[model samples]
Target chain A: MTPLPTWQRGMRGWWRRDPAFRRYLLREATSVAIGAYALMLLAGLGCLVAGPAAWQRWEGLILSPVGLLLQAVVFAAAVIHAVSWFRLMPLTIPPLGRPGRRLADGAIHAGAWAASALCSLGLLGWLVYGA
Target chain B: MTDPETILIEVLRWHPDTPEAPWWQSYEVPYRADATLLEALQTIKDDLDGTLTFRWSCRMAICGSCGCMVNGRPELSCHLLLRDLAPGPVRLEPLAHFPVIRDLVIDQQDFLDKLPAVGAYLVPAEETEAAAAAPAAPSRQTPAQMADYYQYAQCINCLLCYSACPQYGLKPDFLGPAALALMARHDADSRDHGQAGRRAARDADTGVWDCTLVGHCTEVCPQGVDPARAINRNKTASARDYVFDLLLPGRRR
Candidate 1:
């Protein structure tokens, strides 16, 4: 006897598979980068709580090849985050009015870079001073 | 005397009866000086091929009837002048996130169903005998309060935000941006005391939790309702309820 053929469907259930799944992927990737950054800081905190020997061990790990490579990856992720965050900043605020209109798109991008630079310098100064 | 411009319009055409599924059809149409994208589609339909199907009403942006992907961006065809979009060719497709009914027309039932689930109406509190007997005072609205929900109220239920929304794309039942804006309008109202409706929207997995703060809804919205901000504000409300609202007396209600 001949077996019946399985029916092929045209469109799958939209909720199961849809266009927004791509955005969820972006969020997951960004979150992984953020998690990595968090763990790096927590590692420093762990070293501090431990004895000097333990702290040296942490420092050695920081200087090690694997640690350096991880740091490089983190930095690259951070750059991606920085660009994405800047691109999205326009959505947070209302249209910048007539004066903002005068400034070109490149200028808007430059302004975000300037703000990030100021923030990084401020944070570095505070960390170094406290250290 | 006018120079002719060639626009390669990429169109997604589908026929349910056809053995072959939906395919992109390219049409090279001469661009008129002040022609909107709608005009080009009309040109293709009127002269080139009668099989070309699309949905449109009011030829203007008011009806919210003619929403489609204009060059991979969600826009009202009547509003998108071809001169501004003059880069060789333009892409046209049905709005993303919803199932295409046929060609540019998408199945808008999901968005419509969510409207009722969010309680898209004013729910007045219980009218006591004394309260009912009392003279009904006219509800006066200030310019600022009107300003708050006016843009939101102006939503024509166009699925443009749905197209822009990644959350609605992933989770069809998420109620999306426009519905959330409607909920926010009622929740913010001084008269409407529909906490239950707010709770319902706040409690779904696909409802509010699925949103990962991707503010694309606000970005591609022709009308600036800012549904992302509405959802964020309600997240604070939901968190507040979770922590200490029950502890306080009649505060949450």
Candidate 2:
């Protein structure tokens, strides 16, 4: 093949520069934290199956300083993941409005945020009161 | 109103014939409130440096030819005013994620190759036409159907979305935003009946599956065409089809 005289640029530290790309990288990385959390939950389940002492040991490990910090990081990652997911929610579905008057982007964003807040609050209430 | 002042424009320069790699060339151009980056380049070509090369036609955003990197962001040079970017200097470069052919001009052959794979044009249904009625009759469509793909149809094939897409940057095979949006546009149209033929493009490893929904495509769009929405919505469809094909085999089809 004849060599074409064209310059191709490489992608390095792209996320480091643009906020949009940075957020996208964060959103992608949230899955690793989420996966780690799942593994921890599975380990907890295994401990419960082993006996009360094992369960207690697992629980202690989870609630420890390091564990708590890890949990906090995971929680933050999950929140970021969820917010990003909901932001794309409107786009996945058809627009919710008439022809000339379409749903505003502000409305879509607000709706997603509102729904997220309501669900989060409900979950908190359930944890505090019911569970 | 302020007096017109000369502002420095640092443009990335390169040529095939030269042994040297790409470098920046700065030109001082007289700036005005209404003048755009396109006009600045035009000024550079007309008065200052005649060697400056870039592709542009129809100074309006409608042409979609003047997309370039303005200070590390994909923007229509025709649409972005110099006054809004007022300062001593502004950086100009070819659109990212593509091969640079020359100063301020990137290769679009990859995008052109990908567009045909997605079946961007309308494929009409087999005509029964209610016992061979009027051939010239307009295809009637509901407002709701029009709303489905109208935004996607606004795409001018600018390839700014390609520049903005990190996924496309990483993997060149990935059918970038504009092509996928065009695919969705045709699929969503009431007159079109070519979704089945276009499934390979939609479900390929380099298709909608590649999009991470970074949404920079939507952000950088000169027209409000949301390629992220079209790509993501089809992800759901492609995933559903995958599941159905696995479980039901030929039943789903």
Best by DockQ: 2
Off by over 4 Å in 1: A1-28, A44-54, A64-69, A72-131, B1-3, B128-130, B245-253
Candidate 2, residues B148-207, lDDT tens digits: the string is 789999999899999999889999999989999999899888889888888988999999
Clashing pairs in 1: none
lDDT of 2: 0.88
Error of 2 at A35 (Å): 1.9
lDDT of 1 by residue, B15-68 (tens): 656625778899988887689889988999998877888888788887888888
Largest TM-score belongs to which candidate?
2
Give the TM-score comparing model 2 with the true structure, all chains together. 0.89
lDDT of 1 at B15: 65
The alpha-carbon lDDT assigned to residue B165 of candidate 1 equals 73
DockQ of each: 0.11, 0.56
Q: lDDT of all the models against the reference?
A: 0.72, 0.88
